[model samples]
Target: MNIRKTLATLGISALVGLSAAQAVAAGTIKIGSFLAVTGPAAFLGDPELKTLQMYIDEINTKGGVNGMQLELVHYDTGGKAKEAVGFAKRLIKKDRVDVIVGGSTSGSTLAVIPLVEKDRIPFISLAGSVKIIDPVKKWVFKVPHTDRMAAAKIFEDMKKRGIKRIALISGSGGFGKSGRSQVLALAPEQGIEVVSDESYGAKDTDMTAQLTKIRNTDAQAILCFGFGTGPAIVTKNVRQLGIELPLYQSHGVASKKFIELAGAAAEGVRLPASALLVADKLPASDPQKGLLLAYKQRFESKYGPVSTFGGHAYDGLMITVRAIERAGGTDKAKVRDEIEKTRGFIGTGGIFNMSPTDHLGLDLSAFKMLEIKHGDWTIVE
Candidate 1:
């Protein structure tokens, strides 16, 4: 044990320790997102992806989350459930993401929840599905209001407005079916009778027949539900048939593209949406005003104008980041536990409260009733 040899070994050990510490400090946190970037639901997924990119860019520019750069790895599910499941597995097993976000629809979100839960990763679903958070799953959370909540709001509004009869049309998909069932189930309680109920396939190009039947009924309004191109078809056909009754829709049609696709037909359409979309018209001192403006300016600077879908993504990702910050690390389990304890989180959407029994983080109060006027969404009292 010569003195020179002892000193050399001690220096080598110290260098190795410093290298390990640096590696840990410089580690990157990977977030995975699956969306229908190229399929029928591209209208929703494209803006959501853009929002995720904008948020990550801004976070990185501000030194990132906890001094670690955030990396978002996205996959295009093409509106297919099987592809979503496969991508989720790849994100977990290969990319090794710290969390998952930005699923565009209920089907895609629900398909990936099991994979996330199996891998014990935190997943914040941007999709609006009550089932995504129902039963209080530990690894899953959602940003948008559930179809049941939207249905209740729509029906309650109709009842208040003295609409006694309604015709329902929804696509034969998970999102559509869920919304339709919720509306139908809640109509009786709201004292509004569903005069006629009809459904069409997701790929249907025209719903003339269904709209005609509803038009012949004594319904005062048409309640439509679907994602992708189905909603557009419903709106177009309803207009082409010259049905003058009011059209109420699910929040899935909150995107600007929905109005573009439906053109003039969407003028009087009504739906429930997060307050962020109509924030410009809200009072300046509103609680969500600051956050919404900040998010809007950052998003527009990074990637053009922001859409409602983008707003949802921004809210979801920010909440996820806040949970990680509170946890002090990227440990998935710890973050999930903290997320369930989220309270009074004043995000771009609204205040949220996530509990062990409530994973959506939002309630009926989170949504504001809105109507499309002159191709723009206007808040309704």
Candidate 2:
């Protein structure tokens, strides 16, 4: 009887040891991302995903954060807010992620914020919306500046160029409406006049009617706003209508794909964007030079080239990983606390200063004016 008891006790001990080993093996930190990889906003999400992958790969190579491998599991939201909410629930409940990243558009990010707050997981949004960080939930953070800041920059530049009368064209989408509202609200304050205001839906391929109306007006410039393929259509229709005035666009259309989509019309178009997008024009003395170069080289080595969307993703992931490392564990609450204290951490975007009051960590100073010249972006004075 004693011998039989001893054998059973030994077996139980061995089973416990095996279970502990399995737990340790499965302790890898999982990060979640929701993007519109297969929808109208794929141009934005695809590069953002690629950049997240590149940063994850690099972090792992240098001994991952707190000795735990960072695993990013992403869902395709297809540019729908409902899809984004569903995906957020899955990431929080099923995947049990330590953190979440990657929201391609403002509407999708806004939809997922509540879930992130409820689950007490830190979310670093890649989308640019002042509202995303404004009412500032403790768990929600953003790496991109708000659309309001970009709109201000556009108007400031217009004022400098002596452009008083402008034509405003925006798609009837979340980003478009937000940008149009901000511009209209701030134009009078900045002494700029909107001679014509036009709107179009995202699916509309032809904008000649809107462009023609603006062309007939005494507007000295055209301000285009949209994230999807609408900007390209507007650019094409403007050229087709022989409207040769200066063209200014929101940073939402700041990507190499925009140039490809707009073709010749893309040339000489100005927009406000994070300095990382125009790295080539920055001198070596610039603070962001080293970081941007490293990111560019690593990204190009992994994925063909870099884009502004990719830079935002890289900044978001890096900030999240840094906070995780500082926390020394994957505890959600601890990570959230550390993220809120992140100050003066230089990123490709700019210095991040995530406080309890402000989660965006960036302001208008984080952006620089850029103009497309000869199929490439150059910093504008």
Candidate 3:
């Protein structure tokens, strides 16, 4: 599948005037977004844009919340933090959007944090990083699982398989660096030992040197941390080197595109992923199964396949609407408080329980230990 062609196009209707605080004058409840729809992380941000647009169109058709039309003003950040910060300022200072849902990458999200906090605009980041919500910025929240959560889930599964010594090969990007820090920091606490640690840049096309160094170690399994094409390159390199060690990847690669990029080499790869990957395989009694299947069916009907990245956008948008309704108006402070009070909300990623101190709000049960089998996700038995 040519995912580039399948991705959603950027949608921006009109630019807001210089007055940033006037949502009413903007003519609707504006939702501003900054995503990486055309960059290296387009695999993630493109689908996210589609999901948000789909939901907004449906919501508007259904009379919208409190008899108000929701307008989306989004820009493509192209995986650049500085660009995202500029977009955040534009959304708040110029567009007069009531809420901002974006910052597709970990680095981009962090770069926009101070801007959002200073402006007092409610920010719901689509990026994956514990740093986004750890100390809890008053106006910031997230819908995806963090790098710390992914690391803990992988280590838990590794221990179950009697794997103790492991090797790490992570991209030098923000996502990889945060994941690497978590894995190394939690290894000793999880009863796992790191035998090797290697790094590669995001633009690096070959990881043969890193794989060779990792293979030389007495590592029982290898964990690769990266997003988009970088990890796929590592997978291909590991296979070409004829390495027998079990290869595991980060949730950043939770899409069919990764399997296609890695081809036959993707088989048997494991990762800690959101339940959306194997939603149909989940027990009917599970709370998130129905929600997951609904999203999958709707998304596949239009886009041909499903991805967790889009699911993150779906959850964030839905959550934003809910907060708007509970707040009873488009007031940014009221919406932020209502969002923080969100509890028992079922999202595509997991059950959300937002508090002032914890914003991401998902537990270990959110991720499943999944393996690639016959080019699809299957629960590792």
Candidate 4:
């Protein structure tokens, strides 16, 4: 009896070891990300990473997909493109993540694209630059409304207001450069003239010099295309230089932080933003109202308040999750195909309509014209 028991114990131990080996071979479905979690772009990446982690935990709580737990590995790129490229390679080659959702800034997204394309991995970027999807790389996709779309929306709004001459002041960042290009290229088609196009460094504390140049132009309206604190500086500079042209910012500064940064100077400033900014104000008839409200509540409940940048990350992660569910497995090719076939999916950014040719999947309608009133965001009726 003792000999028989000893043999059974050995057999059980060997079976357990083999099971462990098999588990290691199969591996969990890896979801990797790299964002500008620290540094100048922290405002964008902090909320994004938080929202992604929160939703991921929620998914795990409900039980992960296909009876396997999801594994998330993240790195901070400090809003630097070079840093982003290194991490992208590590996530794919070393960590072997099934899907990647990141590149918080446009520069970082553009930086990581070559590696993602070469590896043929499905990369859903949170970056806002239209250049991220313009060439239409098959393996790459994005969540934010393109800068081109935002520019078109702004120009259309300007035309409706009977404004003709506009000045463009952009930052040297990829996002600002992309916005400037689009606005310039589309202005003639839209029957508006760009009287002045000025640029400033991302870290420039003041833009009085650029505003001085813009003041000399016949611009009836001024478009300041930048993110983070650059736009705030423009607002202050515009007010200080006594330039009375209506100031319109890009959607990059569609957060309360901008108002706080610019203080009273941000008053009456106009910009384009997603419905998520004024979700509570949206009527019940609006298609995006429910989804926007739910997301806002969920995010703000845990992480203070929601930023439009955070919505970009939320869109990327949800789209990735939907693609995984639709594909029914961790097959990279199948998931990529599923993501490409996505359509009519209403997200925080817009109603996504992905295809072989259009990876960003947003339109001009995604933008809601907004104004800053008394340090608060109000939808321009």
lDDT of each residue in 40-106, candidate 1, tens digit only: 7787799899888877987999998888899899999998889999999999998888899868988
TM-score of 3: 0.89
Please report, as a residue range, the 10-residue window in candidate 3 with the lowest summed lDDT.
Answer: 9-18
Best by TM-score: 4
Angstrom error at residue 28, model 3: 2.8
Show model 3 residue runs off by greater than 4 Å: 1-27
Error of 1 at 93 (Å): 2.3
Give the clashing pairs for model 3: none
Report the lDDT tens digits of candidate 4 across residue range 152-211.
Answer: 989888988899999999999877888889999989999999999899998889888888
| Cα lDDT computed for each candidate against the true fold | 0.85, 0.87, 0.91, 0.89
TM-score ranking from best candidate downward: 4, 3, 2, 1
Residue 238 lDDT in model 4?
A: 92
In the order shown, the candidates' Cα RMSDs to the true structure are: 6.0, 4.6, 8.3, 4.5
TM-scores of the models, in the given order? 0.86, 0.88, 0.89, 0.91
Specify the poorest-scoring 10-residue window by lDDT in model 1: 21-30
Candidate 2 local distance difference test against the native:
0.87
